[model samples]
Target chain A: MVDVRYETAFTLYPYARSADQDADSPARHPVVIVGGGPVGMGMALELGLKDVPCVVLDDHDGVGVGSRAICFAKRTLEICDRMGAADPMVDLGVVWNVGRVFRDERQIYDFNLLPEEGHKRPAFINLQQPYFEKFLVERIRAAQAEGAPIEIRGKNRVLSTESYDDHVALEIDTPEGPYKIEADYLVACDGARSAVRSMLGHDFTGRVFEDNFLICDVKMTADFPTERWFWFDPPFNRGQSVLLHKQPDDIWRIDFQLGWDIDRKAVVQPEYYMPKVQAMLGEGVEFEPEWVSVYTFQCMSMDEYRHGRVFFAGDSAHQVSPFGARGCNGGIQDVDNLGWKLAAVIKGEAGERLLDTYQEERKHGADENILNSSRTTDFMTPKTEIAKLFRESVLDLVEHTDAMRPLVNSGRLSLPCVYDGSSLNGADDAILPQRTRVGATLADAPTDQGWLIDRIGGRFQLFTVNTDFKPEGLNLDLVDVIVAPDDLITERYLGAAEQAVYLIRPDQVIAARWVNPTAADVTAALNTAMGG
Target chain B: MEKLFTANIDDADGFYAELLAAHEGLSEAESYALNARLVLLLSNVVGDRAVLTRAFELAKQAG
Candidate 1:
């Protein structure tokens, strides 16, 4: 039986020149996103929620073909919630945090990602990329129905792109014919093979992993626990690493490392893969295949995500090996970091120079992802004899000793990027708990009315935990003042001090914190955060 | 319960290459001593006498 949920046909928004533009003139927009994937749709939603209108162009009408990007980290889900798509995604996806690693026949160790309570979202969720794209589109549509000026044009492709000092222009290919569109800023959210990046002649540089992996999604009924399982050299698939993860609809994603010597074409055939599957599941277990593909991963990205008026996001901007679910999760964060800054600049709230922080922060994030993914790739597929010795030694040691367990790198997994040295962050005058610190994403704590995140939704916020200090004279419109009286909030934000105030960015990153703050201090921090 | 043996090395070719390289210029007698020294170092790290005995017995049984 075919799973209809896997096939998503996105509704196409009609393409036409606006009423203000004639046949000889091009339609100009504040922002133009050149991909309809998760990143592009998310960027549009972020801008739309902030009252910015943008056009999203895509060559396809639906979500991705296969069950791609199945792991969504908590940070990504929180960002989606901010962009108005998290509930549907979390409700439909399998929420899981446990992962197990094995060598040959014995399971070495397991991990529980989020052992603490009182958080809004889970550690991670397993949902296919298609569902992710579908939910994001629904969010954009719902906002559009409520008069959010966001438009998505499917079956529209960007044939070429040109950048100018003030704006960027694009040549589009549509079913109706060729048209031109100009934008104050153009974002490339297209997938790995971004036509926009290609036309701009930008170099996406990094290392290419030599090994190929076979990815197969199969619909099966089994009692396997909902945890990530990775094996170094499984008995069934000897001399190759295998990863097994459970997705929604009883579909399981299995990846087998096919070394460079194998016939790439033959490995994908069901005839060749069936025996391996049988060996893995044991003889009589029944299952049906859903999707299959062979892929070689490359950890590469553009040196600079921002080039003049054009910007790149998602796989178009960076690609990591599928081992860690960093590829799409990282893309979500890219849009999250760019969204508020772009919105602020467009609304004349922040200077154009504020846009430069997007590069400073997200490029740091991309480099971190690339570093982690590359190290994981190297450990997984040792290229040298010395590398193999150390890998086996570590694996063998892990089977016996708990000390070596942490060294085992089965995709380090994804975490939020910390902008410790970002120019936008303000100094911490008071010492809080390690969990809540400047340059880190705001730690979620439970409150009486709702979670702290729920109250501090998508705005510049000043949170005062349990302190009744009121601002005497200041521009209160610049920051939303939250007096959190809950004990949990006090412990998280105010450890030893009786009162503390935090200046948070619109993206919920803690910009600054103070023990006893004056209006001048808060105002200075707000200005610095806004690139004043 | 005794710890069961599992297949640890995914790529035997890489493992064998390393194994060969470890004995590159050593004499046969010196290589045998190397094995013994490696076992002693591993045993110290393994720490459990019963577990080490069990592993040795299993290695011999496999042979």
Candidate 2:
């Protein structure tokens, strides 16, 4: 059990004294979310923005306990921007791009993620997980205050769920009492140890890494640079790897590799961790231990994320090692993918078959994250002598040669997952550059109205570059026509062509492209894109 | 198709030592890049598609 006595740094939202009751008995909602965590709140906010009603049920009354998931990638930041929460997150986060790797005391190579910046958000930001959840909750509250139909019930646990053909019946347990509610669709964003998933007996398949890591969040006034620092087999931590990341409020997160086969609970205590931390930071450097936890990495996922009217997102659907910062970042992408589809279905804008595409697309995303994370973990903690030798050779070679820079893998970090073989993808007959490919995420560019992403957001966009073509006798209500007259936009999108057009999905993924598309061509593509 | 460059160098040990020495001070990336350049150069020198294909298949099998 978590220590309830531990005073949280952020606001501990009070559990409502009353239970959620139905005035007409067994309340019905458009959507019911089982967890009120970051992913759940993200889904709520995403749906709320689309004017879809949703109720979020969580057993906890506060945000995350520890400073978990410190790294938020640029793609995640962009998604948050759309949700009306990125500006404060960017402002509060420690923006960074440079990452350095070292073997013993010798530095291998340092890399810059974003050498050039025409985009709005930075490459990466390091904010504590509590703050990320807090910001999402705030967005939900602001929306609710403005009369948006998003309700978050704290200390309300979902005891069981009954899935039907068209709706789901949920038996929820609250502090007050137990109540039953029905939802058009049920989303389980509960967590890694998901109750819903276990209740359903879904098989989570993957490899569990043998190495354990002890994460220590320390608050200190140190002059460490705001770049990711990774050390392999350092003198202080013999035959182990160490990672250092700076969070907000002078709090630094340090992870030390504690080889498997130790008491996990014992290693998390300050007695076992402080000695090693002191050896690295020196005894003179004053510091206070904020939080400590021991964790073993696992790369696992379910075969399917959707089961009839019930859907799983975030940790419920999949999990990856924390090395690549893919866990929470990829979860946010799941919300981005599912939010629009769920809302569209609820609003009767699209067929229920559209929801199946969520499982198909995000399964691809989960696989990609798992593959990359597993590879990074293998490199970081090699299992055999031969593997260690190869790692050592690669690290040694990265020290002096610029050509070997790409070979150094501390962590590849997180990038947006492009829905490359997705069923939603339409035909691409236009001869275009690789960046503007049909299945790729829309490349952001500078425009008169802030940024390119800001303009084409939360809607099916018919983006035309250096061209004036209009769709006639078609339902244009579902699509927004965006005209980019900027030279950079034309250069990046149209290349040397006089005009080009692209059908962009609500999540800002290019569905199809045309050199000179007619109304008939766009209508057929959009029909396929809508899963018609 | 045949073992075209079969243990052709008389001082094989010396050549191996020199090869290792050449990569001693270089970074892992640099050594790999150098090896890639060397492979391209040697491939060009062979100037035969079938020989290059055979060399690739043999190297892969050995690996």
Candidate 3:
């Protein structure tokens, strides 16, 4: 059994007695999110902001120990930005866009992830997972103070769950005792080894890699540039790969690929891994070990995200290898996708069938993340001899030629998922850029009224550019932009067309777009977007 | 999208001889590595994904 009461540095939500403990019947909540990790907290914050009542039950009081998921992608940052929690994260994160790939101590090539300009957020920022969760909780508190119907019950772990036709009943175990509660919707934002998933008897079916990776967060004052350094095979760790990244504070995160067989217990000790860290940092480097963990990853996901009223999000829904930093990033995206849909369903703005689109769209996203992560894993730890031979050949070719550099697979960094061929998507204008097409998360650009994304509040919007064509009888917010001829917004949203109209979803995903769309077209698209 | 079966190589026999000659003095492992590298290099040359996919399917079928 997994230990739910793991100690952490911060106690953001210590257990407290609630009135529900003495209630005659179970308290009914609009949404009950299990596991107060980033996704759950983000879900609560999203629902709370939408005036949807939610209760979060977490086993632990606060953020977990260690700088677990260090890389927050631009898309994740944008999602957090919409939740009013991105400012502190970006302010304290170690921003980086360049990554260098090396093979056997020789630098092959360096890559710039975000080569284009006009984006408000950088390509990625390395922040500790604890701080990320803390910021979400902080935002949750801020929202709660603003009369948002959100409650977090710490030390209240769900022991069992029973799904019914109308609602899902949960039996939670707290420090005091056990209590019963019912929710219109139950979201399992629990981690990969989700107890709720076990209670529900759902299994994640995917390939589990035999290789184990040792993650070490070292605290030291080093002058290493804030860039992701990946070594395929180095002298210190011969025949193995190593990844080094700079996190906030004086902490540096290093991942060492340990072969299939290892003493899991002994390897995490300071004596076993510190020498390896010393060797990698050279002879005279002074450092202190912060957190050490050995983990074997699996590229896995549940077959479905929504099971009746009980939904699965984050690591509970799907899990990818840590190579591409897709774990928590993808989880946050799940929260972003499901949040508005759940809120709309609760508020009677959308039909219950709208929730099924969450399964359709996010399952597609999970597959995409799994495909990229599995490819990276296979390239990193080639199970077959032929695969290893090709991987080595690619590394060899990178030394002398620029053509082979793109083939190097350290990790294809996380990018936003565009839901192509989604059921929720509507009419697409072929004249517009493919990047901002229907079902795509709207690309950010600088506009006259601050950043374009900042102006896209969490609501259905009729986003227009260089046009005054407003659809009649539609009660939607307008993100009207009158920009210069060469504005970045125009370049991103309006390609060959002189003017464009886009129906944007609450989660900032484009539902439909047109060059000259009538009101009936907008109504049809909106209806389709809302699961009509 | 050109089909993989298209006879595009001007000197098929010469190309076959050249390919084998590239791995003339290599050990078993080295020959395997060479073949892998050649596959990668040629795959880049045939950058069209549709053609590459068809080539993969045809090669798999032959085996």
Candidate 4:
């Protein structure tokens, strides 16, 4: 029996002949993205929004089957909102902000991820990966209709790539035949089993866990709340862990941690794993399985994300255990950091040295994700008896006292990265709010025009709050916002200061902030931000 | 910002006796678990990461 729901939801960018196929020489593009996954499409969308020409090539015509990468963090949603692709996702996704941890049959503690009340999106949304890719492709189509120079070629796979001083040449295989194309910058978002990474002979260096986890997406009409439920040493799966999450439809994602020495092939069979699910869900619940797969993850990344004219993003650059929901979130941030700089350099606005900041900032983000995921993996599947002892002790202490609750490590959850001490950062006022300091991503606040995040990005901006101080002759937009006396915009961006000014990057990261500054200060900060 | 090796405990021998008594009647595994919990609690009490890092180095060198 076949389930039609798990099939390709949208046949976006089907195989079509291009002028490059018939040309005697390879057609060159500003950027060529080698994967139609979320990260690849996201990179294209980011460039397309900046009026940069980009081409996306993928082997498949549509989204892959299965409910993979279900958790999209708030930072990812903010990025998508900037790209005009987040509306449908937020509408179709199961929004969740609370997570509950369990031990045996008892609920240890619960946490609200977004305790503050100012942000536009929830802390996280549980939408299947297929829906994520479909939304991105839909946004691309909309951009194309509006005259964005973005092209996607489906059933087109890059067979090999060669790097030169100025461009990268790729041999791509399509259903029709093989064709060649050249790109000034080639981005490889080809996922963990990346052929491009293999072609370059670069390897990810880190630890690989021996334990396997089985994910079962079951469709059942039940009353499970849209909150993440995680268990440690549950009765049904003793000495192991379990995770239950609610998706958009009636589909529920349940992950069972099979021990180290289990047959990977046999465990995914419905005959073997269904009994475990039935035991967990109790008997007499009518349910059908939607998708099932076994996976083992590694917490690893390459030493550098950029290689000459070729760059790696997402799982191709780094792979982490799915404990913290950092996989796609980190990848989205990678392209967000790269897209603007690449566009600026290609447009002759900034020096090529600006692109090196992508490697610097995103490698730090990747390492942070890897470190958190590795800690969670070690806690969940302890390698030594002493490690297990400590884990059990933490779990035991959580049941009785609130002091040890913070020690629980189901997953740290994902947060936006602050590029502290980066070369790109400009002057930062010490008295301003620390959360909105220079090198930090701008926090969303309410303004006269809808959300503050929606009004910024796509270009550098001088964002001012509470005062109408504008500097003339600068090559950037000035967004002067006057809010109520006690609004979150004032509290978040200004702390005890009568006026605040921020020099925001194209990616919405704060380059510099000042309580009071001269026009010369603004010009110097803007020049420093542009790699002057 | 004080160093961790400073003499802080007034009665070191009395505190050592209390620590040994906390693990009196238990198996080897239980003793290890108790020691682990005690280390965690004491580390929380001394919450400075720099101090804990220095303490870790001192303990590791002693072992």
Candidate 5:
């Protein structure tokens, strides 16, 4: 709700002037991240945890309302915990594990993200983005109090940016006026239409979905499953699919499908929407629609995440269908991946060439996510009439065939991305873990429940059994050896001891591994990846 | 086939209720073990094994 009385009361709430006319060195930050969205704030928190100096820019006056991108995967929560924001976030959000799909107003199927053998956080959490951003901003403030340089410029738009050999120069347009800022590197986390990326002429290429979608945020005053309830078909809505999720404080989120033919503007009305809501839910349930928006998704990814010292992340990098809640979560993973690398390069721990691999590996993952979403999106929007009949045929078999259950439910949509080829990743132990590599599960990598995320610790661990020896060419700082077991092996890894020697990268993907391995094999893997 | 991941969520309340029913014999070791598996699963979802490994070890030690 826009308070026009209060908003008009304060006509111009401008930013503070650069009070230090005599302060030397305008390069106040090692890295300046553009766009203060989740990805940007994520990058800021990652850098802040590492005691890295950075400034985050956003043109928004405050964290906007309407609850965008509420579903976050488990990996995102881990990163939030690393930044000391997960507890509050988890407290503020709802832990959702079950989803029920409806067909013609009958409960068709129900799937649980059933807690697996190993998972600390819940499968997903439903929290509005504004509160989420507030959590991160608070963490940024706490980091600033500790003397870690983190300046957040509200209403600061990047007018013009020019990157030199050693630094990035950005002209930020504050309310007072425009001012120039310099930094060692620039990380752009701007949303879909990124001005920074546009200025740099970076091409974002991918397929665009033809169907339009209406996202609705509402206060449900009725009885509905507290889980993520969806309807492939509701009787009142005829053919349009509905994606419903419960938000914080009795609010429910509904993403209504508007086919290629519907008018974008005219479709939003109490007459049109109320029927859709009453269709899935019986007549008595009432809801006050908080925010209604019309949007269409594009399956696109940026060709590059970096140009010289300037970097692109989040929506600026790639986009996917909200089907699996991968877009925002994957973007946060990018920040986790780039945060350490950016900090390391700035601290001179590795060459600047290491920065190039960010585009390579992350872009690859981004494409994978888009493809995954596209597959689901295609399944959702049956193009041919025959295909629609086939989908119906499949849904028909859900109760009859055990083999068909996996087909109908598709179980969990979250799959760990495999890093194929990148300088940072050596590429032997890709399948060693279940999910995101740069996150928390890497064996033998360094970690503390402190500021530096799971990614910031260890020089990649080469988990090897010392018995099967081989030569390794030395002098590479990125390689750390973890002897399989000096009596503490079996309890450490449930995987067989022969599968030892998993070389974990700094981002924590199993870079390479040798079974019953040797020193030479480890060295070769490190040499191939580290170029040492 | 050994289940890489398992969910007793099939019967929702029954599963957790069963765990609560067995609370009399539940040891601290069992609790830690549960926490470890949970941490490991969550870490895998997030795709960070470093924390997974740490939590895994801590769970075993506590056990």
Candidate 6:
């Protein structure tokens, strides 16, 4: 039997005093978030902002060293801005709008992602994950300083947990000792080998790439342009791919494609990767390797994001290949998603039913990310021999075809993600359907990147032109309407813009759109999104 | 379709028009400023009583 009194796990925040309640009912938190990585940390910040107490548990001594997830999408940066880390982050990382692809030393193609800065932030900024974590940890600490009940406990490992009717009893192995803690909700932001997810019997089933890659951070010497550059068939290595990106602190994170045949046990040294670098830099370049790790990309998806009160965010919920910057950014999106919803639920402003929408929205996003990352990875390194040849041919013709330019260059990298179907999505086929052209578009706004409900539309948008029917005299507070002034919206969207007004959610996803937009429809959408 | 949307303040026709401006081209600074104007406009449209009522409901619900 496990001991109940000893609390050994990492406890950054204070636990409820024995004086407050009975021995077992100590005041720790209503929510316990597992894993102390970016997603976990983001959730803690969100909870802290909401005045919801949370405890983050991690077994690692600290954030992982070395460069990983060098690309940060605009959405992730926006969330970091929300947490007050973006300003500093912008200072630390290089904002890249252009990317150049290579086939050996020859520059095959290049592309730009700053599609006129359509939305809030740039398409991406390249930064080291370690430094990014440092900034994130700082914000988390600040939140704690503000008397937000969020704590970070390192070396506090989670062994297992048991969930009953109202709470989950956790059995964590703290550095000090083992402890039994109970929480109203437990979210696992743990990585792919999530013990929490495994304990709940959720399976992460998907494809794993056979091609191995050596990820190395090195100093650059050659006069390569300062854009994210990739080489499909670098002459230095026959039938291998190379991705070179500029990272913060003047380091370059390079990915060298190594076929699966390489020994996994082989140690990573400057020699193993230097040849690739030397191959590209024929002469007059001196660079030293900083850190090197050989990793294989995998695209795996969780069966579900929520199982009862236990929610999984980030890699715990899903794993996307590193391509398209989906791995970390997608997880951050999950944090943004669950953060506000959790506050709404815990505060009782939103119905418990809103909890169900998390799976619907995040799962759809994770799946799309997996698809995008997988597709991009496929283009980068084709497994089949014929596919490899076809990819090579495509790269050869990148000089031609505006249509083929983005195809081979793969705008898939920093392109924003679209949610095809979401409960939070109103009458549109998906949330932010205007931004997503896979199906229909929003009514009023006409922008290529799509319309944000909160920006152009009024706050608490009503989304109706009829203004005629207040029928039941529904309160219009925080509400606005959307009326297509003329053919502008319809033409750009290219059809599928038919509908009355659609009440967009705060996050810009259409909460609901009505064909006729009766008072009942408006009230129903508000009720569904807000739990009226 | 009878659409219900606030005209982006950046638009030449603040709240009405046959043409929709290419709002994407505007800088982030410009867009957020316009958003603030639209929020206050919406607040006015919501009216004082509705605002108080909805705020009270949200507060009560949160409590």
Interface RMSD of each: 10.1, 15.4, 14.5, 14.6, 17.1, 21.6
All DockQ scores: 0.06, 0.04, 0.05, 0.05, 0.01, 0.01
Q: Candidate 6 — which residues are off by over 4 angstroms? A: A1-28, A221-224, A399-403, A409-411, A414-416, A427-433, A436-502, A513-521, B1-63
lDDT (Cα, tens digit) per residue for candidate 5, span A1-532? 1122112112122345564222454544688888777888889888877778877777765566668788877778876876777887888888877878777767876777676533446656888887777788777778778887777766777888888888888877766666677888889898788888889888888888889888778888677768877776676666768777888888888888778888777767777777776665667777788877888878877777888888888888888877887888889889867887777777777677777877877887787787667666765776554445445655664433333344443213554466654565443443333332322244322212322234333355544433434345554333223333332333343234444455655555556664554567666676555433
In candidate 1, which residue pairs get closer than 3 Å at backbone N, Cα or C atoms, i.e. clash? Answer: A239-B10
Off by over 4 Å in 2: A1-13, A17-24, A475-487, B1-63
* Steric clash count of candidate 6: 23
Q: Best candidate, TM-score-wise?
A: 3
lDDT of 4 at A147: 93
* Number of the candidate with higher TM-score, 1 or 3: 3
Model 3 residue A68 lDDT? 86
Name the best candidate (by DockQ): 1
TM-score for candidate 3, please give it. Answer: 0.90
What is the Cα-based lDDT of residue A255 in candidate 6? 80
The chain B TM-scores of all candidates, as shown, are: 0.73, 0.83, 0.84, 0.83, 0.36, 0.42
lDDT of each: 0.81, 0.80, 0.87, 0.86, 0.66, 0.66
lDDT score for candidate 2 against the true structure? 0.80
Give the fraction of reference interface contacts each candidate recovers: 0.00, 0.00, 0.00, 0.00, 0.00, 0.00
Q: Write the per-residue lDDT of candidate 3 for residues A450-513, one digit (tens) a residue.
A: 8988988599899999899888888988989887768888789888889999999988999999
Q: What is the per-residue lDDT of model 1 for residues A373-406, given as tens digits with 9 covering 90 to 100?
A: 8777877898765566567877776666454455
- Looking at candidate 1, what is the lDDT of residue A313? 94
For model 1 chain A, the run of ten residues with the poorest summed lDDT: A1-10
lDDT of 2 by residue, A146-192 (tens): 88888878777878888889788888776677788899988999988
lDDT string for model 4 (A56-101, tens) is 9888888988998999998899999999999999999997778899
